[model samples]
Target: MSRTASDQSLDGLADGSSVVVVSPERIDPDARVRDFDQLSASAQRLFVSEEETNPATAADLDPGDVVRFTDYYRVR
Candidate 1:
């Protein structure tokens, strides 16, 4: 997965940075959207890691975290 400008912008963020996480599958009117810090530990760990080539899950996401989706782009 190629990094977009939005992805690049997330580089070097401090650990625990506030992030609004959005999932393509949950983009319905009734779906809830929440920030990274607001998520439960299990939910936060479920997001796909930014590093597509690695096995890292969102569990390892910190300092420079991002969520990757197969069919969506980061919304600024």
Candidate 2:
């Protein structure tokens, strides 16, 4: 699918930057409202609201808000 502002925003991130993943489904209210890192240490992945998720492609998204997972990484 084509990209959107949110997708472009994420693409602009520096290599190895810490990022919390989110899809187009049921975004964790906590994560959506608060910081992604605020979740528990074990919670490497968090949900994102439809308004917050990127790549605004219907094909990319599931019936509900999608859930994406990724480890937090920082550039050295």
Candidate 3:
């Protein structure tokens, strides 16, 4: 995959970036999604674990999740 400018910044970090590879088949269980409605039902439950209870809020998200989301989705 081609790395965007944002993705490039994460390429060689010391601690390593935490990545959740969401395929068409399945998403990681620990991801905290921003736009839950954009995902399918199964994707929603799997990729958006926090939203199952929190629903549309990002207060409980980790810093990594936010950075990954913005980098991948270009939220900025």
Top-scoring candidate (TM-score): 1
Error of 3 at 69 (Å): 8.2
Query: Which regions of candidate 2 deviate over 4 angstroms?
Result: 1-32, 45-76
Ranking by lDDT: 1, 3, 2
Winner of 1 and 3 under lDDT = 1
Deviation of model 2 at 50, angstroms: 19
Rank by TM-score, highest first.
1, 3, 2
Candidate 1's displacement at residue 34, Å, is 0.6
**Residue 6, candidate 2: alpha-carbon lDDT:** 35
Error of 1 at 33 (Å): 1.9
In model 1, the clashing pairs are: none
Clashes of 3: 0
lDDT of 3 by residue, 25-56 (tens): 23335644455455446533433343223212
Candidate 1 ranges with C-alpha deviation above 4 Å: 1-31, 49-76
CA shift of 62, model 2, Å: 18
